[model samples]
Target: MRIFVWLFRAFIFFALFAFALNNSQEATVRWFFGHEWRAPMVIIVLLAFGCGAALGVLAMVPAWWKHRRVAQRGGDIAPAVSDAPTPTEVQTPSGVRDGL
Candidate 1:
């Protein structure tokens, strides 16, 4: 399964590589802030993908750091729940008897 996944990834990488190589038309991208940047269409696509990935990782950093800190502190901050019930004497219900 792992080998199949790796092969699939490799195939996709090569396919994208070939596509970028074949399509190298220069294009200009207009930013929302009135800035225009020119680059190959493939470069722009790859840059947008890279920026999205970077932003995703950046957004996760704070949560990851908090989890790491909690884990490093021996996980003492988490609440503990007991699975066992409290010790109490059981009483037979009315109209129920033993050896019936």
Candidate 2:
């Protein structure tokens, strides 16, 4: 299993390596007011992917901080409560069910 996993990882690496080699051609990115940026296609793609990932993480920062603050305040997620009485034990086709 480990060998297979390693092989799969290697395959992925080589695939990406081939992609980069194939995309070695230069690319131009146009910006506002006749501004232009240029780089190898692979580098441009990598930069775009990296920036997207970074922006995604940055967008989640507020929610992450809020959850962290709640955790620090000991705000645990309690189980839902019900007014009706629940059975202590019940029989099922597989096995006995005791809510566990």
RMSD to native for every prediction? 4.9, 7.4
- Which candidate leads in TM-score? 2
lDDT of 1 by residue, 1-100 (tens): 9999999999999999999998799999988989999999999999889999999999999989988999898786567986666556566799999799
TM-score for predicted model 2 compared with the true structure: 0.73
- Taken over the whole model, the C-alpha lDDT of each candidate is 0.90, 0.91
For model 2, residues 1-100, the per-residue Cα lDDT tens digits are 9999999999999999999999999999999999999999999999999999999999999988988998899986555676665665534567666588
Residue 41 local lDDT, model 2? 99
Per-candidate TM vs. native? Answer: 0.65, 0.73
Total clashing residue pairs per candidate? Answer: 0, 0
Candidate 1 collision pairs = none
- Model 1's alpha-carbon lDDT is 0.90
